[model samples]
Target: MTKYRLFTPGPVEIPERVLAAMAKTDVHHRTKEFMQIFSSTAEKFRQLVDSEHSPLFLACTGTGALEAALINSAQEGELCLYVSAGKFGERWGKIARRAGIEGVPIEANWGDSPALSKVRETCAAHPEAKVFCIQHCETSTGVLHPIEEIIPMVREECPSALIIVDSISSITTSSLSQRKLGIDILICAAQKALQLPPGLTILGLSNRAAERIQEGSPHSLYFDLKHELKNQAEGSSSWTPAIAHILGLGEVCQMIEEEGLDHMIERHNRLSKLCRFGLTQLGCTPVAEEYPANSLTPATPPEGIDAEVLRKKLQNTFHVLIAGGQDHWSGKYFRVGHMGSFSEADMRMFLGVLYDALSEMEAKLPEKAEFETSLCSFV
Candidate 1:
């Protein structure tokens, strides 16, 4: 297969070491050796979110983890509140509604952050809400919510509410501490900032969340948090595990630990800023005006250029695969992923190929397209 460097929001580039780990000899999930691997991987995974080490690992996408979090945290006829700022944020309400829970949407413009006053108002109105859902970084718009501020405010307003943070695309790309922020449930996956192929969903929980699951009905066997906690605490999954993904996750965690979490966050932030700078130099407009996510950046093509056309051109002409928009913004903007395995050198490569593609398109060029290409700060 031809190797096309991918810049999609999730499933970012995989490191060679992680790939090697996944390709190594497979182990039986029921064996003591596999249990040690599972238990060790779970510990490392929780540290990524700065949470206590006892997170649940499920062989599913971020959506499935979100579902598991919602169903297991809240019961039927319970009140659930969520922010509807982008594609993933909208999922919270949809999931709640599907679960027969009363879901309230705290609406916001797609690329804008949710208003703090509005969120506080929602908390006041729905004081009985079982769980309040919000995405740390909405991948579709690349908008990073002020969770550090929002979480504290929500905690103060709705003391009884269980706050659920979907950090799927934001974990390693951005900085967050689940315990410090008082988050009840934190969900992430192997694909995004973990630098691994999709399959594993890691959910970090607090003691309160575990108690809720113990007293409440999860409604499903596979996603039952109570059962998973009891079994996984003993180094076993309730069902079949994704052996390769677990192994890859262990390698990724080790890599991040060695690199230092603070340094990794700085690297992703540098790359994300550099990507936006390069895009702006090419006469493009970044989608997120405020609090943009470090994981990826969404931008509109230079004036008069179709986003889809540019995305395909980048893929076909340059062998660089970027992503187009979803839902109402489809064909309106394109996104570039710079999280996980992407490094300073990769960001430079992205700038070069993007410049080449735009030059071939003969798109109206910026009068003075000046952006930093210096790696001095990066090193």
Candidate 2:
């Protein structure tokens, strides 16, 4: 099998040590050995999010955590406000509606951040909204929502609202602190910047959110936050946990600690800047110019050129996997993920592959000599 480097978002390249950690003999979940690992891993997660309350680990994806947040916080008769700037952001409302909760939409065009004043206006208009859902980074458009500014505005209008954040792709790559940001619930998955495989969702919940979960009954047996919390307190999962992923996660956390969270975040920012610069040289305009995410960069190809076609060419010929746009932006743009374990050399290698692939396609690109010279500064 051909070894392809992943430049697509989610499931980014895993560190060798983390991959090796997963190969350790699996222990029974009920055993003290597993509990020790679980406890340590939980503390690492809290430190990553800067949360005082221990996070709830779910044996599912980020979307599962999002649903749990809604099911535990929003009641049937109460209003749930949703501010969506991209596909994943809109998913909050979709999940809310599926859970039989009323969602008040505060929609913005993809790649555009919703104005804080407008969001404040929406909050004021929907004072009854008890739950507010936002995304720290919209993976689909590479748009980083201004969570810090928006949170204060929302709190001023609805002081008691449960602010739920979907930071699946942003957690380690960007600056997101659940406690410092006053975020009630923050959702993350192992696959993104955590440098682990899928199947494990890390959820950071505030004390207030925990109280709400304790007060309410869960709508889902599988995603029962209260039951999971009880199991977590006992240093286990409600169901059989993904042992390999958790073990790998512990190693990833150790790597993060050794490297320092601030350094990891800086690396992501550098990679994102390099990606945007290289894409621009190749005649692609970044989708989110104003507030692009450090996790990834979505670039739109020049008109009349299909981004999906270019993505396929790069994958087939260069064995580089860059993702195409989703929903309405499908075929119109491509995305390059710079999160998790991607070194400066690795980034340059992907850019070189991209340059070669675009050259072969006869795409309108900047002079190869100049482009490479510019890329070297970041590398």
Candidate 3:
């Protein structure tokens, strides 16, 4: 039997209350009862993103939201800038190409965020660019982009550009507000810091973004923001919606509202710091020290130890499952997720198991140093 706890970046473990909420008797999407749930969920979403405007709901993954944001905000002939630093960032570039949109990508090293100065310079040169795409948190490398700094530069340098952000992993955990930041499109999913199961995708759109959609593009159908918004106004969806997922999202939103969004972000921040402190004492280095993600930590495996082997041992022996790196960093680094219904005890359990695994690998720590260091940060 698969008995290991999940610590992967996405599809994190869900709370029992949230799952139970999903198990409630189903209702028709067009029913007034369902609309009440939809409206309540949308309000919570606005609070999550700190937006005053309504957002579109989709029955797909984060990638589908990205596609919607891209196709709806810009057109086939219009130039769009895709900023890439990790695997998820690259996915945006690939989506743009497949949509036949004129896209120019600015790439940074896998473990680092794109340089704000470089992004500004590119935007200044491309005066005709219609949209600038960014990922708020790059899950692949645990790097958080400085969207606040980059967005202002794009606004000043390329006033016509619509800022589209993939906030799939950052929205609820990070310190970003859609209204304060002036983001045109903010995309997120239920499976991240929302502490719910996968299936429901949510997006917040600024009025500016909605106005731009009137110009239209040929690449969208079910993912079209205009269509979704119209259906949403009628208290319905464009098609058959994920009723259970929406119900679960409403329950998750209730939990978030009760906990308060600020407290939730602080909780993730605390867990992230605790995880980092424990990993550092284990002699592992962080991938992005300058701007590490609050939701996950990507740590380089100690020398002479295979990252995948360590991850496997943590799962099979200790029943503690962490994540492995993707793309170029695969087998070189492993990720530990600290988002969604996680606490200090969870962090301690993971670190204790990791400590045991390292000892089994014959990786020596300096006497009681690791434990002492972790206590200082965690306690």
What digit string (tens of lDDT, one per residue) describes model 3 on residues 1-379?
Answer: 8767888888789899988988878588888988988888888778778775787788888888888888887777788998889998888778888888888888999989878879988999998889999999999999999988999998998899999988888877889899999998888898888777787888788888888876785566777667777888666888888789888888888888888889989999998888888888888887789988999999986778889999988988888888898977889999988889898888887877788898898886655564866566555
lDDT of 2 by residue, 190-288 (tens): 888988888998889899989988887757888877888888988998899888888988898889889999999999998888888877777888988
TM-score of each: 0.96, 0.97, 0.96
Better of 2 and 3 by lDDT: 2
Which residue runs does candidate 2 get wrong by more than 4 Å? 377-379
Quick one: ranking by TM-score, best first? 2, 3, 1
- Candidate 1 lDDT, tens digit per residue, 1-379? 7679988887788889999999977578999999999998888777777785489889999999999999988899988889899999999988888889889999999999878999999888877888889999999999999999888777887788899999998998888899998999999888899888889988898888888878878668788878788899999988998899999989988999899999999999988888887787778899887899999999998988889998999988789999999998888899999888677788887877887788788887643233343323334
Give me the displacement of residue 226 in model 2, in angstroms: 1.2
The model with the greater lDDT, 1 or 3, is: 1
Model 1 ranges off by over 4 Å: 366-379
Residue 83 of model 3, lDDT score? 86
Question: For model 3, which pairs clash?
Answer: none
Clashes of each: 0, 0, 0
| Quality of model 2 by C-alpha lDDT | 0.87
